[model samples]
Target: MNGADVIDIARDAVYTLLIVSGPTMAIGLGVGLLIALFQALTQIQEMTLTFVPKIIAIFLALVLFMPMMGAQMGDLMARLMDRVATGG
Candidate 1:
């Protein structure tokens, strides 16, 4: 592929990655910030307190967003395959 074609593919790949990761990351970030605030307020500075809820939320988010993420990845892969087929 030429430089412009490669740049296009790279841009699409990054966009796909962001789409797939956005939900889970947002969940994790929200949960972690909440937990941190709670810890600061309550003085319950246990490490597990910090990690457990955020992890759970992230996992839940992953479960909920899995189908959408998969579809995005599949679309990117199909586009890549098409580029390969046509010698982009």
Candidate 2:
């Protein structure tokens, strides 16, 4: 493939990756930020306090968004396979 083709493929992969991972990441970030604010306000300096809630929130988000993630991944894979098939 040429530079344009490589760039297009990389762009698509990045797009698909972001689409697949964005929900869980956003959830984790939001939760973590809230927890940080709470900790700051409460002056609770417990190191492990921040992780559990963020992880749980991210897990829940992943579970909720699993179908969409799967579809995005599947579409990206199908596109790649088609490109390979057609020698794109």
Best by lDDT: 2
Q: List the residue pairs that clash in candidate 1.
A: none
Off by over 4 Å in 2: none
Query: Candidate 1: global Cα-lDDT?
Result: 0.89
Residues 1-88, model 1: lDDT tens digits: 6789989998999999999998888888888889889999999989888777877888889889999999999999999999889887
**TM-score (all chains, Cα) for each model:** 0.94, 0.94
The digit string of per-residue lDDT tens for model 2 on 53-81 reads 98888888988999999999999999999
lDDT of each: 0.89, 0.92
Off by over 4 Å in 1: none
| Local error of candidate 2 at residue 67 (angstroms) | 0.5
Task: Return the lDDT, model 2, position 7.
Answer: 99
